[model samples]
Target chain A: MKTEKTLVTITEEMVLNYEVIFGKQNKLPPTFPMIFYRYINVPWDYKTAPIHRKQTCVCHSELSIGESYHCVVTLDQVKQKGKYMFYTQSLVGYNLEGSECFRCVSELVVH
Target chain B: MCVRISRTLTITEEKIKQYAFLSGDFNQIHLDQKEAERYKFKEPIAHGMLTMGLTLEIASSFTEKGMRISTYEMQFIKPIFQNDLIYIVAKKKKQDYGSIYLEITGRKQNELVVRGELALERLSSIHFNNATKESGM
Candidate 1:
């Protein structure tokens, strides 16, 4: 396989694709009647070990029912892509309510 | 306070399939038991992300009125096999009107197989008002 990089946007189709993967869309209480967004970039045909590097930024539209929140997550490989494959995911807590967004970011390398 | 709950779940092949569909993670280890056994795990295991997603479901059940998860972190500990009766648990260890800390765990036959913690900010109604005032949401 050749090395490839794909940037996938969170759209209705992508959400449907994820729903297909999980089987039951209702099992997860998605903030429906609203839109959920994410950006996924994957590097294929990795030269080193088959390690996947991902970054997820999640945001939801305002809903009439409950409170709305925005959160961001950044995950990086801890190891130098050799010996061991280590990955660490950092979460940023943001309420996105009242212009107040909680934010935090962490990095990890797997060997 | 920690938001927590527990339930015994039948990890059926169909359930796994659904999870695979939702995550876009159709790895063979989760779909093929025979191929899974060939690997070091010796049995088909669920996707780590899927397991985490399930754990999130369990935690969401305990959310108090008007509260939503703002952030969380999970680490994959062990593989959950198909048809295994696994116990899933989540607890709220700390909380406030603004933020909450949650601890979640998963077990098979009473043995610890997975564990993680989450930090969720309480989604307040005040923000939606501002979003509406600013963006007409």
Candidate 2:
């Protein structure tokens, strides 16, 4: 059987799921390059906001030293006003030799 | 090629409900079976992120200080239903600058459900300090 891939879409439900599974103690990582969001709580209603359609590119191959692959995430724009919005957020990948790569999600907002 | 990483994790409505309650996700696609029927699957399915995060636990199994994923990507090609036992697998791909690349797969009943690549960076004082400084610390 062929291996299937999962596209990571940011919705209100996703935030809710993360909260339910990881709990507040395991909050989602903050927007990269900015730690200010670390203190901001992930509101349960975050799922109720509008989000960009995200395209996830998950590679399933191993890499050697000095090798790198890009995980490009495309963020769609929101049309509704004051309904909240999400953007295509980028994260730096890891360097562990054998562990799985990072599983980071995009950003959601009330914009 | 396909590999097995974990025991079959049975997907259940009750489990889905708890995830919904915790994630605050009210998407009809995951909660209302009738609503999901309108979709191709014709039933509620597990949240993609939920499945993604669950793999992190599997990553923890291989390390002690904990695994830090730096990059990850996946495509949702199949619908995974509740009560379905999913066999999970994660493999080491490569390493750069204390970061590791991983190939992850999730399958149910010997069928592939999801696959993706993940990159994990270790939390190091030198790396962290350099990263923070590069960001204008």
lDDT of 2 by residue, B21-118 (tens): 55555567777777677654567877665565555555554334543444456655577777777787777776666666678777876788878776
Off by over 4 Å in 2: A1-111, B1-7, B125-129, B132-137
Model 1 chain A lDDT-worst window of ten: A28-37
lDDT digits (tens) for residues A23-77 of candidate 2: 4323233211121112223323334432223224222222223433232222333
Weakest 10 consecutive residues, lDDT, candidate 1 chain B?
B59-68
| DockQ, model 1, C-alpha based | 0.16
For model 1, residues A1-111, the per-residue Cα lDDT tens digits are 111222222355545655554333432232221122122323322233221222222223222223444434444334455555555543333343434333322232222
